[model samples]
Target: MSISPEKVFEVAALGLGGNIGDPPAAMAEALRQLDRRDDCRVAAVSKLYSTPPWGKTDQADFFNCCALVETSLEPEALLDVCLSIERGMKRVRLERWGPRTIDIDVLTYGTREQKTEKLEVPHPRMTERGFVMKPLADIAPDLPVKGRKVRDWLEEADIGGIKVAGDQDWWRAR
Candidate 1:
């Protein structure tokens, strides 16, 4: 369904990562594509960071960042947008938590919680991933996820190898 450009939508957050094939460029392209959509708006983006691989630690470290978005699309539709962006970036699903051209995980959609086979809101692993929280704090430090603030979670998470890759606004720096 085509969304009218004039429509408004609930605020949402997304986690983006890409460690292969010009990862930063991949993320920038994805951001540009999302903003080009009439259904979504790229509200805010965090600076870029390089974090030690999460889950599967056998490959390249991921370039991680988070985005604050405004969207007229619902959770499932928004997820479709993310997956479309990944596919556009030449992402192939060969392994879970494996290296990819791009990875976009739906972190939260208006405080909703879901456990469907298609998607999950407040991304099941958001709180546990410092790569997600650190950049998230850059945009919305006080932003709450499942009743807990990003800053608070960051303080509690073991963010050992997450490094600051750049100080510029990665989402709009293209």
Candidate 2:
């Protein structure tokens, strides 16, 4: 038996975060840019979440969300698109985990595991972030992470002050 090319699957999991000017608007613009790609389709999006800065907590809190997309592009190509969107949004990567006008990360790209100098699939640290897990679980409740259910991981995850920001649809329909 052999697997068919048509059956070869590809899906995209994107994590969006921003803390600089009009974070919500920046996210909406990112979604619109993703929607413009012919090889990808925005399938579902998680609710917006507000969480304290993870690493350098000396900055503004971040507005975060996750999006599940269906894309035929390989992980690296998809990553390129994400970076392009960031640049177009005037994103300034001044510091590690620092406040930004917009930030987009490829959290997962199908089940394919990949590592390159510039990108990593199934984002190495995604499972450890509550902001990522919370929204991911909401949209993909049964999603498996390191062999555990997303919901389960969320339960024990230290999400302290993370809160649902506003109407979920408000961001998606943008």
Say which candidate scores most in TM-score: 1
lDDT of candidates 1 onward, in order: 0.88, 0.85
Kindly provide the TM-score of model 1 when superposed on the true structure, using C-alpha atoms.
0.93
How would you encode candidate 2's per-residue C-alpha lDDT over 109-150 as one tens digit per residue? 766778899898778888889989998887887876667777
Q: In model 1, where do residues sit more than 4 Å from their true spots?
A: 1-6
Candidate 2 backbone collisions, by pair: none
Off by over 4 Å in 2: 1-9
- When superposed on Cα atoms, how far off is each prediction in RMSD? 3.0, 3.5
C-alpha lDDT (0 to 100) for residue 144 of candidate 1: 79
